[model samples]
Target: MNYTLRTALQGLWHDKWLNLLCTLTIATSLFLVSLASVAYINIKTISAKLPDRFSITVFLNEDLEEERIKAIISQVQKHKSVKKLKYISREQGLADLRLSLGDADYVLEGIEGNPLPPSLEIGVTRRAVSGDGVGRLVRD
Candidate 1:
Protein backbone atom coordinates (compact mmCIF):
# COMPACT_ATOMS: atom_id res chain seq x y z
CA MET A 1 0.00 0.00 0.00
CA ASN A 2 2.82 2.41 0.86
CA TYR A 3 4.68 1.63 -2.39
CA THR A 4 1.51 1.94 -4.47
CA LEU A 5 0.74 5.35 -2.85
CA ARG A 6 4.28 6.59 -3.42
CA THR A 7 4.28 5.41 -7.04
CA ALA A 8 0.92 7.06 -7.70
CA LEU A 9 2.10 10.37 -6.21
CA GLN A 10 5.34 10.23 -8.22
CA GLY A 11 3.45 9.50 -11.44
CA LEU A 12 1.09 12.39 -10.87
CA TRP A 13 3.93 14.76 -10.10
CA HIS A 14 5.92 13.64 -13.15
CA ASP A 15 2.93 13.90 -15.51
CA LYS A 16 1.38 17.03 -13.99
CA TRP A 17 1.28 18.99 -17.28
CA LEU A 18 -0.15 16.03 -19.24
CA ASN A 19 -2.70 15.38 -16.49
CA LEU A 20 -3.72 19.04 -16.47
CA LEU A 21 -4.12 19.03 -20.27
CA CYS A 22 -6.25 15.86 -20.11
CA THR A 23 -8.38 17.36 -17.35
CA LEU A 24 -8.90 20.55 -19.33
CA THR A 25 -9.82 18.57 -22.47
CA ILE A 26 -12.43 16.55 -20.57
CA ALA A 27 -13.89 19.71 -18.97
CA THR A 28 -14.06 21.54 -22.31
CA SER A 29 -15.65 18.51 -23.98
CA LEU A 30 -18.22 18.26 -21.18
CA PHE A 31 -18.96 21.98 -21.38
CA LEU A 32 -19.46 21.79 -25.15
CA VAL A 33 -21.75 18.76 -24.76
CA SER A 34 -23.80 20.61 -22.13
CA LEU A 35 -24.03 23.70 -24.37
CA ALA A 36 -25.17 21.59 -27.33
CA SER A 37 -27.78 19.90 -25.15
CA VAL A 38 -29.09 23.27 -23.99
CA ALA A 39 -29.17 24.58 -27.56
CA TYR A 40 -31.06 21.49 -28.76
CA ILE A 41 -33.60 21.85 -25.95
CA ASN A 42 -34.12 25.52 -26.72
CA ILE A 43 -34.56 24.87 -30.44
CA LYS A 44 -37.04 22.07 -29.73
CA THR A 45 -39.05 24.33 -27.43
CA ILE A 46 -39.17 27.12 -30.02
CA SER A 47 -40.17 24.75 -32.83
CA ALA A 48 -42.92 23.26 -30.65
CA LYS A 49 -44.41 26.74 -30.18
CA LEU A 50 -44.70 27.30 -33.95
CA PRO A 51 -48.00 26.51 -35.65
CA ASP A 52 -48.32 23.08 -37.25
CA ARG A 53 -50.19 24.42 -40.24
CA PHE A 54 -48.27 25.12 -43.46
CA SER A 55 -49.44 27.78 -45.89
CA ILE A 56 -49.88 27.46 -49.64
CA THR A 57 -50.79 30.23 -52.05
CA VAL A 58 -52.86 29.62 -55.20
CA PHE A 59 -53.13 32.38 -57.76
CA LEU A 60 -56.29 32.57 -59.85
CA ASN A 61 -56.66 33.82 -63.42
CA GLU A 62 -56.80 37.60 -63.71
CA ASP A 63 -60.12 37.50 -65.54
CA LEU A 64 -61.92 34.94 -63.38
CA GLU A 65 -65.50 35.86 -62.49
CA GLU A 66 -66.78 35.85 -58.93
CA GLU A 67 -68.81 32.68 -59.54
CA ARG A 68 -65.80 30.87 -61.01
CA ILE A 69 -63.71 31.93 -58.05
CA LYS A 70 -66.38 30.61 -55.70
CA ALA A 71 -66.40 27.31 -57.58
CA ILE A 72 -62.64 27.04 -57.24
CA ILE A 73 -62.87 27.79 -53.52
CA SER A 74 -65.54 25.11 -53.14
CA GLN A 75 -63.35 22.64 -55.00
CA VAL A 76 -60.31 23.41 -52.81
CA GLN A 77 -62.43 23.17 -49.64
CA LYS A 78 -63.25 19.55 -50.51
CA HIS A 79 -59.63 18.53 -49.97
CA LYS A 80 -59.06 16.74 -46.64
CA SER A 81 -55.62 18.30 -46.16
CA VAL A 82 -56.82 21.88 -46.04
CA LYS A 83 -57.43 23.05 -42.50
CA LYS A 84 -58.28 26.68 -43.27
CA LEU A 85 -58.41 29.03 -46.30
CA LYS A 86 -58.77 32.68 -47.20
CA TYR A 87 -59.42 34.36 -50.57
CA ILE A 88 -57.76 37.61 -51.59
CA SER A 89 -59.15 39.69 -54.43
CA ARG A 90 -56.89 41.43 -56.95
CA GLU A 91 -57.55 44.85 -55.37
CA GLN A 92 -56.69 43.41 -51.98
CA GLY A 93 -53.52 41.88 -53.41
CA LEU A 94 -52.53 45.21 -54.92
CA ALA A 95 -53.22 46.97 -51.64
CA ASP A 96 -51.11 44.43 -49.76
CA LEU A 97 -48.32 44.87 -52.31
CA ARG A 98 -48.53 48.64 -51.88
CA LEU A 99 -48.29 48.25 -48.11
CA SER A 100 -45.27 45.99 -48.47
CA LEU A 101 -43.60 48.36 -50.96
CA GLY A 102 -44.32 51.44 -48.82
CA ASP A 103 -43.53 54.60 -50.86
CA ALA A 104 -42.12 52.51 -53.71
CA ASP A 105 -45.70 51.53 -54.68
CA TYR A 106 -45.65 54.45 -57.11
CA VAL A 107 -43.59 52.22 -59.41
CA LEU A 108 -46.55 49.85 -59.73
CA GLU A 109 -49.03 52.69 -60.43
CA GLY A 110 -47.58 53.52 -63.87
CA ILE A 111 -47.42 49.88 -65.06
CA GLU A 112 -51.08 48.87 -65.44
CA GLY A 113 -54.55 48.67 -63.89
CA ASN A 114 -54.81 45.88 -61.24
CA PRO A 115 -52.17 43.65 -62.87
CA LEU A 116 -52.21 41.26 -59.91
CA PRO A 117 -54.46 38.22 -59.97
CA PRO A 118 -56.72 37.15 -57.13
CA SER A 119 -55.42 34.31 -54.99
CA LEU A 120 -56.32 31.73 -52.38
CA GLU A 121 -54.29 31.11 -49.24
CA ILE A 122 -54.59 27.68 -47.73
CA GLY A 123 -53.32 26.33 -44.41
CA VAL A 124 -52.57 22.64 -44.57
CA THR A 125 -52.71 20.47 -41.46
CA ARG A 126 -49.40 19.16 -40.11
CA ARG A 127 -50.24 15.58 -41.04
CA ALA A 128 -50.79 16.66 -44.64
CA VAL A 129 -47.46 18.48 -44.96
CA SER A 130 -45.68 15.27 -46.07
CA GLY A 131 -44.40 14.91 -49.62
CA ASP A 132 -47.05 12.44 -50.76
CA GLY A 133 -49.82 14.46 -49.13
CA VAL A 134 -48.54 17.67 -50.72
CA GLY A 135 -48.30 15.88 -54.05
CA ARG A 136 -51.92 14.79 -53.73
CA LEU A 137 -52.92 18.34 -52.87
CA VAL A 138 -51.07 19.63 -55.93
CA ARG A 139 -52.63 16.98 -58.20
CA ASP A 140 -56.10 17.94 -57.02
Candidate 2:
Protein backbone atom coordinates (compact mmCIF):
# COMPACT_ATOMS: atom_id res chain seq x y z
CA MET A 1 0.00 0.00 0.00
CA ASN A 2 2.83 2.41 0.81
CA TYR A 3 4.54 1.65 -2.50
CA THR A 4 1.21 2.20 -4.37
CA LEU A 5 0.70 5.54 -2.65
CA ARG A 6 4.28 6.63 -3.48
CA THR A 7 3.84 5.63 -7.14
CA ALA A 8 0.49 7.49 -7.38
CA LEU A 9 2.01 10.62 -5.85
CA GLN A 10 4.94 10.48 -8.28
CA GLY A 11 2.58 10.09 -11.23
CA LEU A 12 0.46 13.00 -10.06
CA TRP A 13 3.51 15.21 -9.67
CA HIS A 14 4.77 14.25 -13.15
CA ASP A 15 1.36 15.16 -14.73
CA LYS A 16 0.58 18.13 -12.50
CA TRP A 17 -0.60 20.33 -15.38
CA LEU A 18 -2.85 17.61 -16.81
CA ASN A 19 -4.37 16.89 -13.36
CA LEU A 20 -4.95 20.61 -12.75
CA LEU A 21 -6.62 21.00 -16.18
CA CYS A 22 -8.89 18.00 -15.53
CA THR A 23 -9.89 19.37 -12.09
CA LEU A 24 -10.74 22.81 -13.49
CA THR A 25 -12.78 21.27 -16.33
CA ILE A 26 -14.80 19.15 -13.89
CA ALA A 27 -15.45 22.14 -11.57
CA THR A 28 -16.59 24.37 -14.43
CA SER A 29 -18.92 21.69 -15.72
CA LEU A 30 -20.45 21.26 -12.27
CA PHE A 31 -20.89 25.02 -11.85
CA LEU A 32 -22.64 25.32 -15.21
CA VAL A 33 -24.97 22.43 -14.39
CA SER A 34 -25.90 24.03 -11.05
CA LEU A 35 -26.52 27.38 -12.72
CA ALA A 36 -28.78 25.79 -15.32
CA SER A 37 -30.77 24.02 -12.62
CA VAL A 38 -31.27 27.25 -10.65
CA ALA A 39 -32.41 29.09 -13.76
CA TYR A 40 -34.87 26.34 -14.66
CA ILE A 41 -36.39 26.37 -11.18
CA ASN A 42 -36.75 30.16 -11.16
CA ILE A 43 -38.42 30.11 -14.59
CA LYS A 44 -40.89 27.47 -13.47
CA THR A 45 -41.74 29.52 -10.39
CA ILE A 46 -42.32 32.67 -12.44
CA SER A 47 -44.50 30.84 -14.99
CA ALA A 48 -46.67 29.40 -12.24
CA LYS A 49 -47.38 32.89 -10.93
CA LEU A 50 -48.44 34.18 -14.38
CA PRO A 51 -51.98 32.84 -14.06
CA ASP A 52 -52.64 35.14 -11.12
CA ARG A 53 -51.80 38.14 -13.29
CA PHE A 54 -53.73 37.02 -16.34
CA SER A 55 -56.27 39.51 -17.70
CA ILE A 56 -58.11 40.29 -20.94
CA THR A 57 -58.57 43.69 -22.55
CA VAL A 58 -61.51 44.22 -24.92
CA PHE A 59 -61.45 47.35 -27.04
CA LEU A 60 -64.79 49.01 -27.86
CA ASN A 61 -65.80 51.20 -30.77
CA GLU A 62 -65.49 54.92 -30.17
CA ASP A 63 -69.12 55.48 -31.17
CA LEU A 64 -70.62 52.89 -28.82
CA GLU A 65 -73.59 54.31 -26.94
CA GLU A 66 -73.80 54.22 -23.13
CA GLU A 67 -76.74 51.78 -23.14
CA ARG A 68 -74.91 49.41 -25.43
CA ILE A 69 -71.79 49.60 -23.31
CA LYS A 70 -73.80 48.88 -20.16
CA ALA A 71 -75.48 45.91 -21.85
CA ILE A 72 -72.09 44.53 -22.82
CA ILE A 73 -70.84 44.95 -19.26
CA SER A 74 -73.90 43.16 -17.88
CA GLN A 75 -73.36 40.26 -20.26
CA VAL A 76 -69.70 39.96 -19.37
CA GLN A 77 -70.53 40.07 -15.64
CA LYS A 78 -72.78 37.03 -16.02
CA HIS A 79 -69.77 34.78 -16.56
CA LYS A 80 -68.86 32.70 -13.46
CA SER A 81 -65.14 32.79 -14.16
CA VAL A 82 -64.94 36.59 -14.19
CA LYS A 83 -63.42 37.92 -10.99
CA LYS A 84 -63.55 41.60 -11.86
CA LEU A 85 -64.50 43.91 -14.73
CA LYS A 86 -63.44 47.51 -15.16
CA TYR A 87 -64.63 49.87 -17.88
CA ILE A 88 -62.09 52.48 -18.90
CA SER A 89 -63.27 55.57 -20.78
CA ARG A 90 -61.13 57.20 -23.43
CA GLU A 91 -60.13 59.99 -21.05
CA GLN A 92 -59.25 57.53 -18.33
CA GLY A 93 -57.18 55.50 -20.79
CA LEU A 94 -55.22 58.62 -21.75
CA ALA A 95 -54.58 59.44 -18.11
CA ASP A 96 -53.40 55.90 -17.49
CA LEU A 97 -51.08 56.13 -20.48
CA ARG A 98 -49.64 59.34 -19.17
CA LEU A 99 -49.07 57.80 -15.76
CA SER A 100 -47.33 54.83 -17.33
CA LEU A 101 -45.19 57.04 -19.55
CA GLY A 102 -43.91 59.08 -16.58
CA ASP A 103 -41.42 61.68 -17.88
CA ALA A 104 -42.13 60.79 -21.51
CA ASP A 105 -45.78 61.90 -21.28
CA TYR A 106 -44.86 65.12 -23.16
CA VAL A 107 -44.52 63.03 -26.31
CA LEU A 108 -48.27 62.44 -26.27
CA GLU A 109 -48.95 66.16 -26.46
CA GLY A 110 -48.34 66.11 -30.23
CA ILE A 111 -51.42 63.91 -30.74
CA GLU A 112 -54.48 66.01 -31.65
CA GLY A 113 -57.04 64.11 -29.61
CA ASN A 114 -57.41 61.04 -27.38
CA PRO A 115 -56.61 58.33 -29.88
CA LEU A 116 -56.94 55.62 -27.24
CA PRO A 117 -60.20 53.70 -27.35
CA PRO A 118 -62.49 52.87 -24.43
CA SER A 119 -62.11 49.27 -23.27
CA LEU A 120 -63.05 46.67 -20.71
CA GLU A 121 -60.34 45.22 -18.47
CA ILE A 122 -61.36 41.78 -17.31
CA GLY A 123 -59.64 39.80 -14.59
CA VAL A 124 -60.41 36.08 -14.28
CA THR A 125 -60.09 33.56 -11.51
CA ARG A 126 -56.90 31.52 -11.32
CA ARG A 127 -58.78 28.36 -12.32
CA ALA A 128 -60.09 30.14 -15.40
CA VAL A 129 -56.56 30.99 -16.53
CA SER A 130 -55.37 27.38 -16.22
CA GLY A 131 -57.52 25.98 -19.08
CA ASP A 132 -60.15 26.96 -21.70
CA GLY A 133 -62.22 29.27 -19.47
CA VAL A 134 -60.67 32.43 -20.90
CA GLY A 135 -61.30 31.18 -24.45
CA ARG A 136 -64.95 30.53 -23.76
CA LEU A 137 -65.34 33.97 -22.18
CA VAL A 138 -63.79 35.61 -25.24
CA ARG A 139 -66.06 33.66 -27.60
CA ASP A 140 -69.14 34.74 -25.68
Which tens-of-lDDT digit does each residue in 32-134 have in candidate 1?
A: 9999999999999878655474688999888788899999999999999999989998889989999999988778867868888899999888777778888
Candidate 2 regions exceeding 4 Å error are 1-8, 130-132
What lDDT does the true structure give each of the candidates? 0.89, 0.94
Q: What is model 2's C-alpha RMSD?
A: 2.7
Whole-model alpha-carbon lDDT for candidate 2:
0.94
Q: What is the lDDT of candidate 1?
A: 0.89
Q: What TM-score goes with each of the models? A: 0.72, 0.78
Error of 1 at 47 (Å): 5.5
Taking all chains together, the TM-score of candidate 1 against the true structure is 0.72
lDDT of 2 by residue, 4-117 (tens): 999999999999999999999999999999999999999999999998889999999999999999999999999988999999999999999999999999999889999999
Query: Residue 102 lDDT in model 2?
Result: 100
Off by over 4 Å in 1: 1-19, 42-53, 102-110
